[model samples]
Target: MKMKFEFQFPDIGEGIHEGVITKWLVKEGDMIKEGDSVAEVETDKVTTEIPSPKTGKIIELKASNGDTIHVGDVFVVIDTEGSAEEVSSEDKKDTLAEKKEIVEEENAGVVGEVISSSEVIAPSDEKEGNSASENVAGKALATPVARKLAKDLGVDINKVVGSGPNGRVMKEDIIKASKQPSEAEHKEVLDETVKTTVDAKEEKIIVEEEKIERIPLTRIRKTISQKMTQSRFTIPHTTAMDEIDVTQLYEFRKKYKDSLKEEEINLTFMPFIIKATISVLKKMPEFNATLDEENDELILKKFYHIGIATDTDRGLMVPVIRDADRLSIIELAKKVDEVSNSAKNNQIELKDLKGSSFTITNYGSIGGYYGIPIINYPESAILGVGRIVQKPVVKDDEIVKAWILPLSLSYDHRIIDGASGARFLNMMRELLENPEMLLLKA
Candidate 1:
């Protein structure tokens, strides 16, 4: 006797309501094993693998690749040798990198009507999805990053031949395919389209039709839009800008470059900036706090956890470094590299993106001077670091050359006044300008 096991798309946690189906790892009659990866789902924050809950053969897939599915929607089904059973607590998992946070939503276990063949429009429903390569229909076999890059560049991943191992597609393949059409060729194609449209209009009754491109927003983009709008409208923002001389900080990194290499850690100015921010936050605790609007109180945090903004192909992600006050500059640099890399590769834990008391956005690496960065909501302030450049300066009434770093600080004006905001920026400016000031405990 064959028993049916339904796989529902449970909420992957972190308040995510929906996800985009990126890949289907298994199709009908293809798998036999418990805990095998059945599919990959991409949320706004991360990409997660959907594991098979039982040892069985896949009978039907309920959603198509690239379909947007919601929490509680049935996504797949399997046939096992035992009697049918409801989805238990072990049905869904929220796996983010090595850190696995269990989905704690009440009754997250499978609770859905038996998926009929006519209910779902998945690739497997029509053809039984037996062919491994053809199972996902025309969807390309690429990693989540590669798929995102393809979508962003408007390239057809299915048409771009795979250059990766095991006939898998890669980001570079999509990039090269996108570059295949030159400007002249693109213009020629456009001209032909216009000419064809005009000839058709002349042949038949002319019906005015506007030509426009409509690109659907991804889950990440949607979430970004909502959060940014909420932050801008809800939070009263005030920005303070200033410049800091980083001549010594530059020399400091160069001086410690060799010794730290023995420890296998890269020396970047970010750690110095973080160290200075931590010291400044300690001196002025208000900078490292959250607002409790309902209670009308400032929720002051005892520990210093900093969120570093990382720009990825998917979107902007701020991965937190917990207890940054305890870590040394070298340790912070290593954590920085780990989190930044994990975030860009879509392997960062959701927990790493949470619990940020303060945020620092460093666009300096990309050559931006300064920006009025939005305060990551609930947090009182965000500090922005800009490009470092050598500029003429006045030192004791004498003209001198100094490496200057530009800074922008945006804070919640309701919680922090303009004068207090200036004080915080000045403190940060002083600590960063004089790198040794971080050594002072007070």
Candidate 2:
């Protein structure tokens, strides 16, 4: 007797509703163990590996690669040694009742009466029922659209007083609540009026708006947009910026390029930056943690798996360089080149991008001076490196030429504060300015 279990898509983060199947790691008839990777699911923010929840033979794949699957939609089926009837009678009863309740709710009217004919439910009457539920539950009862709007605007529905009939919350109510200025705005206005003398201030000027064109988002771009919106609204982000003098690093790279060429290795600045970041992260372990909201726990990683942000023709991809702490600078340079080339050619495997403990983005390659990169959710922080420029600096009370690299560090404020973030950035700067430290450790 063979038994089957359906593995539905799990919520990756926040309350995301769906994800696209980027690739399937296992095929039908493959024997899989519990916790083995099953598929790569690409949400709007990141492409993450989904593992097998139970050990069994995969009998069927419910969805194909590139197909969009919603939350609770079955994506895989596993066959065991028992038939469906072997499930306990109590479990069968519970399942049947749940199905019946869903059907009944679909067919029933707002007041609990069965609708006998084809008729549209009045929005007004539905609003009343929702309001009544809210009153009984002591929370705002909102439609899915209204809830999604509130989420995008970062508004708390409970604090928003509904203006619709029977106090049913509406999207308009949420928008109005978000638009209400805080007491700080009022204070600022009063202070401005007081500071400006009778005729000293200039007249306010209004500028006409320019026409904006809308473009459809690509698959990767769409995911980026949704994830960024979610991060901005859900997580409190604080940024720390610092500048490091990398003159010694520039000279060292130039000195070693020919030697590296002899070994068939293409040396780059990214590997050195990545090594320095991993070293600093090892010292500040809290910067390499994840928030397990369900368990109310913080997971700190001891090993370092660094994510290298690669800009490809398709989009932005961060392929991980696993165990960077253990690899030599030359080894790291080779791995970076391999991963980056793979990402550019679209030959990178899903596993190559998973299990990153930290991430570093080299915006300097494109001449960006500084940038506040988003925290790759589930990871505590990300390091951004800007272009190295020769600028004037004061040395021994005199100005001189110095090569400076601007660094931007963004972390989840809920987990780490400004002081810790600053310390982490400073340590990275010190390591980069003096590459000998990294070599000594190696």
Candidate 3:
């Protein structure tokens, strides 16, 4: 006597409609406890594991590896009641039927919002329903966005495998599948079924064959594009570039490098730079403010939360350091190390990745020099630090060897002007050049 229950893919987050089933942790007949990981689904920004809802034995796997599952489709079926249970098969069936009737009656008006084909949608305030492009019995399942993206990319939605829940096609899967080589003389087929009003007169059309391959953007890449575009268009950007010598700053770090290493905190140039930026931001509050374009207001932040831009295999991620103004140089170094390590390993959480008064991108660490970094939107500005190179400088009335750092300060021209940006930057350069100023804030 076993009671079978199906588990559908749950809505992970807003705007996240589907997922690609990367791998299954359990096979059929494997006994699992409630909350045990059953499968890994790669979604936007995070690779999440679907957990078992109840203690049971997996009787059937509805999805295969690399399959896309939709929000409402069943992925696994489990028998909660064991075969040795006291209840008979007939009794279990009768109870299940009663439960089904109750569920159907309650969800009578919301059949389209089904979470599971056989199971009832939960009684929650949150809305549930697949997009219009959801696959029916004979149609290819896909989200409306996926279908539109496919059309834009000149791809056949049917050819793209849905990695979403219950084999539902997602935007990522469509983009990935479109990367595959097609026929040498392949021509993009337009979806003529989509209704559009056009003059009934004959129009000349030419199909240019230039051997072009269209690459679809990943979700992370798509997000980056949208954010970057918004930042470019919404804000009138201005860049302030300067060079500073860090001879004393280098020596200051060199003095305590061995001592900091003993505390398990790797001393990097970032923490020192962050401390200097924080001090400058505190004195110049306008630099750490957001311009409310809609309300015609500028909101100045009192607390200093600095965002560190880190490059990962997925994409560029910025994790914030809260209360950055309160931390010492050594503390900032440890925090920077923790966040950087977590970002590189992809172990950072959503909460840890958000909330920043300002952002700093150290392109210098990767050997880059002089980059006008786009301001992380809503935030007023972003500071870009380039490589520190040894160069000849006029010191004590003589050309001497010094470490020079390239700095690019890109800010919202609407809120921050040339004179203000220069003032803020000059203060930052002053602190960077004279490491003694760092101790004032520390």
Candidate 4:
């Protein structure tokens, strides 16, 4: 009772069309059961493992590592309780022939057949209009430098007779070969190669490639590039910059930094910024809305899902905090730590990265001053926070040092005017400057 089954690659996530095979967990002829993982695949959205549907022995793996497989394509074949004897001799022969054909097809472009001959052939004479460039093995032997010189002189090294030991081509041989051409067309080409008044030997020089390194973009990097390009091109972005005097807020955070640390909760300025931004977004509903281009309308989101832009080794990822308006500052701090760690470790879920009404990027964590961050499209705007530095400010006609935080607000010009954008940043500054007002309003 042997049956053959072809397993198709399923759609692992919504809107996933294709995936690259990252690894193979099972090979052909291996026994497996239902729910066993067969391969790990990376799509534009996420990386996950594809599992088997039936319990059987693996008969064939249709795709190899790094191959791209589309949804509904057969990726593997399984044999249910099938033995080798169950296959007839004709089928076995056919399988062997198919495998041989595949090997030949793959190697035709890159691999050459080795040819050997025992018969001896005499070398061509110089006056016979023939070249004695090839050896008994039918290939020219030349040093890399000689080959480079031949290339620069527009001379085919394979057709030039070398005078060195064992017919090894030298720089002098290449220069001589350039001056004498056996064929009329080749001689014309050499004349054109030496168009300058200088002699061929004096003009010939090998130009080496510039010193640089090239690296292929990873899957996450490609996705980030595509999304950023789309957002920048589709939206007309305008950034407004300002500085906030957060002397009181800085003192407020320092008082609770140690108390929160004892409870295993790390305190940072991000949660306070998040709270202030959320309060401003609620009042200015247009900031938390998306433009419906097809219908010519603005769709405002009722719920507060804030996106925190996190930097990881892979790239920048924005993970959303759902219902952020309902969470306290302490809860927001805990959730921020959890999601950021997950993104850095590559353990974050797909759902956690979507459904954000607005985003905030804190480049200040890494000592960046002010940056014009691109608005994460489909959302109307993004908030950028810069480093807090102590500087002297005139207070009561006297100079005093105060902590100043810089802010950059980028918004879509199609929906928001310059005045509206400035008002948004001013509201955030007011909330951050007064801790009592931020706690009461947020």
Identify the superior model by TM-score, candidate 1 or candidate 2: 1
| lDDT for position 345 in model 1 | 93
lDDT measured at residue 359 in model 4 versus the true structure, 0 to 100: 90
Candidate 3 lDDT tens digits, 1-442: 5777767788876445666677899999899999999999865455778898878888878666655566765678789875333223333433332222111111111100112122131211112243324434334455444555678657887666566644456667766766665875257665543322211122111225323333434445655666677688888899999999998999988998999788888988888899889888878888899998778899999989899999889778788899988788888888998988887887877667667889999999999999989988878999999999999999789999999999999999887789988998798888889888778755
Residue lDDT tens for model 4, 310-349: 8987778888899999999999999999989988887878
lDDT: the better of candidates 2 and 3: 3
Off by over 4 Å in 2: 1-215
TM-score of 3: 0.72
By TM-score, is 2 or 3 better? 3
* lDDT per model vs. reference: 0.71, 0.69, 0.72, 0.74
Give the candidates in order of lDDT, highest first: 4, 3, 1, 2
Clashes (candidate 4) = 0
TM-score of each: 0.71, 0.55, 0.72, 0.69
Candidate that would win on TM-score? 3
How many clashing pairs per prediction, in order?
0, 2, 9, 0
Clashing pairs in 4: none
User: Alpha-carbon error at 404 in model 1, in Å?
Assistant: 0.7
Misplaced by over 4 Å in model 4 are: 1-3, 82-208, 211-214
